[model samples]
Target: MPVESIHGRGATRNATPTRFNLQERMAEGDWLDQVEALDGVSSRRTSVTIEKPKSILTRNSSPDIGFDRSINAYRGCEHGCIYCFARPTHAYHDLSPGVDFESRLFVKPDAAKLLHSALSRPGYECAPIAMGTNTDPYQPIEETWQVTRSVIEVLLETRHPFTITTKSNRVLRELDLLVPAAKLGIASVAISVTSLDPKISRTMEPRAPSGRKRIEAIRLLNEAGVPCHVAIAPVVPQITDHELEHIVEAAVEAKAAGAFYLPVRLPHEVAPLFRAWLDEHFPDRAAKVMATIQSLRGGRDNDPNFFSRMRGQGPWADLLRTRFEKAVKRYGLRQTRFPLRRDLFTPPEGAQMRLF
Candidate 1:
């Protein structure tokens, strides 16, 4: 777990799959496999595979989740956030959730088409569809793939309401669409600012937009009449917990509409990957951080309880909430939700078709 080895990656190595797959690679017997893998087989090269999903919008009924429908243009994220809760999902694809989750990506190139098809369905509802809830819709590959932009185009044409939560400043590229959508009360964006410290951000997210860039993006988006909020996510105890107030202050300074924070949750394979990251970077304070995290989670790595999951119940959680509540009040960020236009929704086939 050398610093030099993990320079470009978030997790130093890929973890074993949690679920058994037909083809599994065991490093125990094959020294040649290790040799081949180490010899530049994965020297920071990105691999993008096409995912032909039958549908784009995914519906979830988790009580704690804010939105019911969402679209993830990509299966894995290149930003390489070590503590990402979505990492374990890679197991279903017969892939490792650690490094492989970041390197090997699956892009749904036909997402926009599928979304239109879903919207065309007779029983389709007009509720807002969220994007970037699972994987970031705007990643490095997005510049080339442009899948997210296409999806937005479809939404715009259909007059659909949607929200985007992302950590990438690259979302600025779609300002033309977002600016108009915001005016129509159809769109809003939230950016995650984990730490104001550039050093911590680099190690934590690896390839995500810098803290400064995300703050600036918020400022620009808000200036352009778009509702922009800040999310202080996965506030790692003993590591990033100290930066809570500072991040909120910076977000306010950046003109963020409002702000919210979530305590770090290490679910499934994410625990080991995050532990690996801790051992490599914050070795000195790893135990204390985990101990604090456990204290917040009822002596476990995670608390999957519905309401408490988003807002941990404890003194530490209380402190985080206090700081956030005070910060939002001090900044005078627009607390009232900038509601999206669900009523303005029109079917993909237009008014004449809706008349039927």
Candidate 2:
């Protein structure tokens, strides 16, 4: 995602269409022509739409990510974290990845049905499924669609293993399923916390739950026997970077099983969006911040290389890594990952079961 605007949203900004739509996963951009406002001037409100996808399961063998298959219940995230690497994906829909990425959202209502169909295949292989890999599965719209919960119901019913990550405490709504799944060695959750500073969090993640709320969610999840960990993501250099140790400390206090951090990544549009954010919030240190980030990213806004993308390089990266390692050691937190059981998977198709 290339930078769209410093304005609020990761909001639906009207921008030129992107150059590629490889598999033709494209849609015409919509406009309301109704009244909305930005910069104290009028603008149009972004609209949400329902989309029916032909399939939901996405397979990625990238070494950087832990899972091979994943499902995203929603296309755009309302939690509008400006530095979201996934935001640029909205451009494929011929819309602005900026505002549209946040204001405009799309939900897959048939996610559960789709999953059932895929799992019913004769040679279907069972593996830990990752949810919210592209966008937060438990975003605000899930409040109404309940699509995420619907998908989880299918996973639980079929005895499938899955993991979900989110910054929203809304996850608790489905704890009934998560708790039992964990008991069966089939579920894990990671709550990403950027900063404990209320002011920084509110500005950077306008719609996400407060850091306090997310940490509490971890504490509660840990109590329920679910493996909950903390991800201090997009560690903004010179700004939120200082809170790296504090976030891990808080996660430990909340009984988080593990903690990790990823340096800010500005794949495409996110670079400019993040730059704008720094200029607005940390004007005095904006230049220094980007400089430090570039130094860590091989003198570029981002380093898309495989292993290094997750594990950064350079002096600043080394420092953050060292800090994270010491903090994890201090908290007695070994790798916080829990392997879900693939053997437990059961096909939902009655015909297959009847044949057995």
Distance from true location, Cα of 42 in model 2, Å = 5.4
Error of 2 at 102 (Å): 0.6
What's each prediction's TM-score? Answer: 0.92, 0.90
- Tens digits of lDDT, candidate 1, 152-260: 9989888899999999999898999999999999999999889888888889999998988999999999999888998888799898888878887888788788877
User: What RMSD, rounded to one decimal, does every model reach?
Assistant: 3.8, 4.4
Return the top candidate by lDDT: 1
Off by over 4 Å in 2: 1-46, 351-356
Give the residue spans of candidate 1 off by over 4 A. Answer: 1-6, 21-23, 26-42, 334-338, 350-356
Q: Model 2, range 1-356, lDDT digits (tens) per residue?
A: 22223345533334444556434332333322312222333333445689999998999989888889999989988888878999888877766677678877888998888888888889998898999788999888888899888888888888899988899999988889999998988889999999999988777888899999999999999999999989888798888889988888899899997777788888977787788777767889889988998998899998999988877798988898888888788877665665678888888866333211
How big is the RMSD of model 1? 3.8
Report the Cα lDDT for candidate 2. Answer: 0.81
